[model samples]
Target: MENKAINSAYQYAFIGAGNMAQAMMAGLIRQGLAPARIIASTKTVASSEKLTASFGVKAVQDNSLCLDADTIILAVKPQVLKAVLNEIDRQKLQEKLVITVIAGIPAAFYYDLIGSRLRLVRLMPNTPSLIEAGMTGAFAGENCSADDRETAKTLLQGIGQCLWVQTEQGIDYVNAISGSGPAYFYYFIQCIAKKGEALGLSYEDAETLAIQTALGTSQLCLEQSDGNPERLQSLIDQVTSKGGTTIEAIDSFKRNNLSAIVDEAIQACYDRALAIGETYTK
Candidate 1:
């Protein structure tokens, strides 16, 4: 493998100035990467101005400038990705590392449109990245060098923890798990808050309790996860005695097939991701 300096020295260009892009840029800047080393493109002049002002990175309207960058982060939405790909000079990307945060599009789809020689990394980042507590899943294509993978991992780690998978297909699983996982937590938190409200707590109090409980539980899990394989299950079992209230709730969830419902929901997300990939690949 080449030295770390080789990978870390590359210039970054973001093709979209959206929330995820901004989150990544902010994280990089916070982690001591020079802001001037990064650049971004936005749709409108006003947006470009705002991005430049907000992040101190060069912002431009022309997407072609990104072709000159050593690393191009495709932060655009899936719907606009086709247009962006059509406009860019794919040949210019042959020597560059292209990292994408766009959901539902596989690395092979990009290679099919561009040349297969392009080094590519596909990523799925959740919303919590804005606050630096997110989880991202990354997968690199066959042509991607070890240095390219290292660079991608370093950039993503600035925002949150990143998990790398061997197969490109694993990206779709990441999409189903962590990418859409935050919304599942949000939905459950909403239900818990509502239940609290129904039980006579004020809305604000209920919401605070619900959110804080989530944070505390996650922290507890993190603290207990030091090589204890069954730590999470152990924690759950500890909370549920033979005839306790927790056991009653667990039994109710079991009777109602909650686990099956969650599995079905995750499967639905995975299926939709496959359908979207099929739509764009053709």
Candidate 2:
């Protein structure tokens, strides 16, 4: 990649202006993009006002006026997408790369909705985006040019990590992993916190301990991860002495089939994502 591929075409018009959009816009602005270059539009006048005041970006009430933005982001809820995109003619929504962070809907849906030949990038980004630590998985439509995908990658990278997949189905896989993975980790920590509380720790201490453990584990993975993850797990197992507390805990988890349970839960998420796309057209 050349230095010229840095960043291009500001004037991003965020259609939803909701929490995710705000977080992404925040990440972009934090990366040195000017606030004057952003345009956020939401259905609620108050939302528009709040964003404009908070970010110093231009705001608009209607989708029609949001067209002034060079790159258009469809950030509304999945349920309202049909009605929202219905309001804007497909022909007019063309030219610029249309990126959708909304979950469940495939990139091709946007392409088909806006008529084929329009550039589209569909992304599945989690709530962590609010803090700029988000992990996002993006996929480009067949019609999307390489430049358009790179632009989308550059824009999304401002907030968090991103990786592209050849098939849009990868977004559903992403929905199972990083997108929904955060909540899974949180739920696990929540249970751990509760367990700590049962062991006589104060509620705050229990929560803190559980969260710190999770954070430290994640950081370890980030810092020491090699191509093979089982090696690290083996190292962990070695550190956890034989017939020790760690072994006891590991035995309990294995007895309860924790791995299978987590796998099944992820499959449930993946199935749900596919089902949503199947029903969208109906």
Candidate 2, poorest ten consecutive residues by summed lDDT = 1-10
Off by over 4 Å in 1: 1-9, 226-229
lDDT, candidate 1, 27-86, per-residue tens: 888767777888898999999989988989889999999787779999997888878988
Model 2 TM-score (2 dp): 0.95
RMSD of each: 2.4, 1.8
lDDT of each residue in 11-78, candidate 2, tens digit only: 68888988889888887787778888888877787877888889999888878777877789989988
Task: Write down the worst ten-residue block by lDDT for model 1.
Answer: 1-10
In order of appearance, the predictions have TM-scores of: 0.94, 0.95
Give the local distance difference test score of model 1: 0.88
Best by lDDT: 1
